[model samples]
Target: MAIFTMMNSLAALLLFLISSSSLIAASDSPFILAHKKATLNRLKSGAEKLSVSIDIYNQGSATAYDVSLNDDGWSSDIFSIISGNTSTSWERLDAGALLSHSFELESNVKTVFYSSPAVITFRVPTKAALQEAYSTPLLPLEILSDKPRESTLDLAKRALAKYGSLISVISIVVLFVYLVATPSKSGAAKGSKKKR
Candidate 1:
């Protein structure tokens, strides 16, 4: 009888522990994601510039509070901000919400610029410490270049890839014209007979 009682006690303790763990895990939390992209553009006056864009997404079970982003990783001596601010913050980002920020930068240093990833931070309801995330990293870019890096052959290949359907359509039209304008063998024979 005592062993049975002990078994029942153990079973009750196990059930209590399981219920508590599930209750702890049922709380909602927030998740923040940031995507960054940078593009290089050349001006007609032979000036080179850079454009940076960042997209923030909240894909969590709860809303995030105090969401902030900072993209000021570049050195001031190398690149100057043309427009827009480098840092921004929001009061809250609900679950599945999206935000976007952009800024333009210009440099005349004439060197290869290695970019850095943007940083994002936000607060979650279930945690005390602020959560941080890094954006997508970009590739190195050449600034203030005199000419494009692609050769004429590469440009031709790109053009062909872009207009391949037009070339095929022209070929089909030429074949159709040839088929309609040329006389058949039987027609040629009948014409010769008529002439004779």
Candidate 2:
């Protein structure tokens, strides 16, 4: 009975350690997804300034330190940071950092603009890294709009069309009232004779 009890206790402890380790791994892992936009809405074929924002969340017990993003021309020269508890402005931040960057683009900027993959590398301490992997996969950026054309008349027409039904009903009511209130020829002549 004593031997069996010892064996059972050891098995339980092993199970507990494995479950805790997997939980920690999940918490430390990074997940990233691309934001897509239409092709027409892409910037003009020239030097343009662009700002890119990325959100990073730390769900693990240990913090991620020395977070760095590697990309071609896609990275912003200046970075602006925001998170649930704080806000910061920096080109780079250490572990547990969420940052957004803004930068000027060169004329030949091709790879980062399209559906190209962007690599972002970050590190956690050996303790944390072992518990949960510090690296995340490439996240692609998509253009937000398909086309960039604009027209004043189109905007006005769209506005009118959106409220078109209401306008039509009001217009019909006004026309009916006008018809009812208008004096007939016979009534006008009678009023003239009465005045004389």
Q: Best-fitting candidate, measured by TM-score?
A: 1
lDDT (Cα) of model 1: 0.86
Report the Cα lDDT for residue 135, model 2. 27
Cα TM-score per model: 0.65, 0.33
lDDT of 2 by residue, 111-189 (tens): 3343233344445445444221222333443333234576999988998999999999999999999989998899999
Cα error of candidate 1 at position 178, Å? 17
Stretches of model 2 off by over 4 angstroms after superposition: 1-47, 53-55, 73-97, 108-115, 126-149, 152-196
**Which prediction has the highest lDDT against the true structure?**
1
Please write out the lDDT profile of model 1 over residues 17-136, one tens digit for every residue: 889656644657766778888898987766678899999987666888999999878889888899998899999898879999999988877888787889999988778999998898
Model 1 clashing residue pairs (backbone): none
Q: How many steric clashes does model 2 contain?
A: 8
Q: Positional deviation of 20 in candidate 2, in angstroms? A: 15
